[model samples]
Target: MIRLVTLQSGIAQGLLWAILTIGVYITYRILDFADLTIEGTFPLGAAVTVVLINSGMNPFLATAVAMLAGPLAGLSTGILNTVFKIPGILSGILSMIALYSVNIRIMSDKATVAIAGNSIKKIVATLFPAGTVSNTLSTTVGIIVCAALIATLYWFFGTETGCAIRATGNNSKMSRSMGINTDMMTIIGLMLSNAIVALSGSLIAQFDYGSALVNMGQGTIVIGLASVIIGEVILIHKEHNFAYRLFSVVFGAIVYRTIISVVLTISGFKATDIKIITAIIVAIALSIPVFKEKAAMRKKRNLAMKEGK
Candidate 1:
């Protein structure tokens, strides 16, 4: 039997991870590049949000600003890769390292902040009219806002600029040959991806009992990639529609979180094992195409043998 509370928590965690999955989607899927900077930027956003909220800023506004910071982080990585001619992987690594100091600064020079005192929930309570209705209203507001943002992203990806971005990812050489500035597209795509990641981190800091630590973003990229892969595994057939494919990342993120929740609920599973499990899952997902190819050949050979008989 499934626990309702655990199920809801898993869904919330999944939604949070969706933001990271989208970020990875931009670099891994869209740009056809590997970017490690996401791991740092996620924590940076959370740190920034925590600091601002503790200082009496509006939690929602703080989270929004935090999201905006993600693009700037991505832009730095893009510049390193494109302008300096650094390898995509190396550029992402350099940017991720540099962001550690920036994240610390964002946290007001603290390694972590305790949010038990000044929290988004407290702010919501004060802002809304007193009673149980207020709590429901706040939760509803957050969910609606997040859902709207996701929907808007879906629509935006269908626009002309978005198409250019996708083209840059699908075929950089061809895109350049057709007069598209592939470099510009790369920068823009990373910016958009990281921005969503930051937004997710900011919201998570608020929702997951407040507070943010310097290492909060560790393993973020892996989690995002796992979500993308898990979603693909579930909706293996929707590869044709770009919109649906993008949305699949979100669903995958949720599913990934749900699985983790179930595992944790079962006794004796160490939470730290999550990273190990995620890596294995991604590896298995990556092998799917290869396995399918081998299976197809075997099937073809069996059919030929039957024909000969």
Candidate 2:
């Protein structure tokens, strides 16, 4: 029974975090840039939402503000990379490091900030008022929100500007030659990506943890990469359409969280080992394609040897 509850909770959390993974995919996969600002923006969003909620703002509005703040972080990284000519990875690292202090300030110099008002789940329960299960409501909300986000992204990416962004990622030199401002595209992509990430963080802080902590986003990059890689592995042979790939990332997040929940239920799993386990999972997922290619080459070699004999 406890395990069942744990699994359900994991699914709910996974759905929320999938938003962040999708955001990561925008920067890492689509933009071909490793922007580590997500680690900072995640906690920054949580801090902003929690502080606003504690100050009597509407929960939904607070979440929106949190998302709005995300773009600023991304913009900073973009400026550092484009204007100052810093390397992509370094720019992200600088932005992430700076956000630590910013997040602490946002939380009023506290390591954590507890929310004071009703959570979204409770608010939904109030609207229903008919023995609405909090877990089920939360999960339902997560699904609806994720689906809406994915649909919106699909539409946006099909636009002219979106195609230019895609072209910038595929070949920056060619995009520039074709009159696409690669720098502007990078900034826009990063802003959009971090906005989604922060939105996820806000939801997580409000619905799951009930507080925003400074260290809440620790090791987030690994988890996001793991989710993306896991999804790609599962969809290795699927059509490379945008909508399908987005859905695959969400599914990957669910699977990753499910695996973690199951591991935690085992007898000898220590809480501190979670990061190590996540690392192993990500490593294995990333190596799958390489292993497959190597196997294929070996098989080809064997067939050639047999023919020669």
Candidate 3:
């Protein structure tokens, strides 16, 4: 049996990352854009939250401000891509690079900003009787928050504006022909995506680490991509409803974290090997569908030859 504390921690971490992965899913899978600005926006959220909390602001309010900061980052990328006519990938890269400096400025040029008061985990602990497991409470909070977010996204994506955005992603030329403002839809999608990513960063900083580090968001995009791919691979045959897809993304994050925990528990496995392992897992997940298709083609060809014989 998996250890209770370890399981709780893994679930909490997975839930936090699930939020980020959902954001990635919007841009990568929904909008069909490889927006790399998430790498900057994630840390930007953490920086904003830590700065506000250290200034004696309420944690919840600080998190809200952090979420707001995310849209601005996304808008910057949108303007670069839509207004300035830069390529989608390039626009995201430019925005991400600029946000690195912005994040440092937000932290007053400090590489790390620590929260001065009780961490969010401690605050949640107060809600339970003394001696109750903090990880369990935090994980519960994460689950509730994630469920709310997924529900909101599911509803939003079903609306007229949401359909327009989906159409924009599916085919920009077709969307434009249908009188949809494809550029505007793209901007809105990016803004919403980065906002969610920032929100996740803020929550993770407050509830888990109580500190915002400049490099904390490095490799975040990779993890997000990995989660998205893993979820798609696992749920390939399931109904593709928006809510189900969103839930699958969250589940994927949980599975990814659990795998990492299990790997760490193995003898001779070091923490430094995590990125390489994650990359391998992502590569394998991504290749599965291609391999399956190739095998199917070969099988069809063999059947045709046997029938001809």
RMSD of each: 2.8, 1.7, 1.6
Shift in Å, residue 289, candidate 2: 1.6
Q: Score candidate 1 by TM-score against the native.
A: 0.89
Which ten contiguous residues of candidate 3 have the minimum total lDDT? 1-10
Which portions of model 3 miss their true places by more than 4 Å? 1-4
lDDT accuracy of residue 209 in candidate 3: 73
Query: Which regions in candidate 1 have their CA more than 4 angstroms from the true location?
Result: 116-146, 238-240, 307-309
Models 1 onward score TM values of: 0.89, 0.95, 0.95
Alpha-carbon lDDT of model 1: 0.80
Question: Model 2, 165-240: lDDT tens per residue?
Answer: 9999999999999999999999999999999999989988877888999998888889999998898888757568
- In model 3, the clashing pairs are none
What lDDT score goes with residue 20 in model 2?
A: 91
The window of 10 residues in a row where model 2 has the poorest summed lDDT is 129-138
Q: lDDT tens string, model 3, 1-309? A: 567666667787888889999999999999999999999999999999999988888888888999999999999999999999999999999999999999999999999998886556667788889997656775787798889999999999999999999999999998999999999999999999999999989988877777998888888888998988887778758567899999889988888887887788778999988899899998898888799999999999999999999
In model 2, residue pairs whose N, Cα or C atoms come closer than 3 Å (at least 3 residues apart or on different chains), thus clashing, are: none
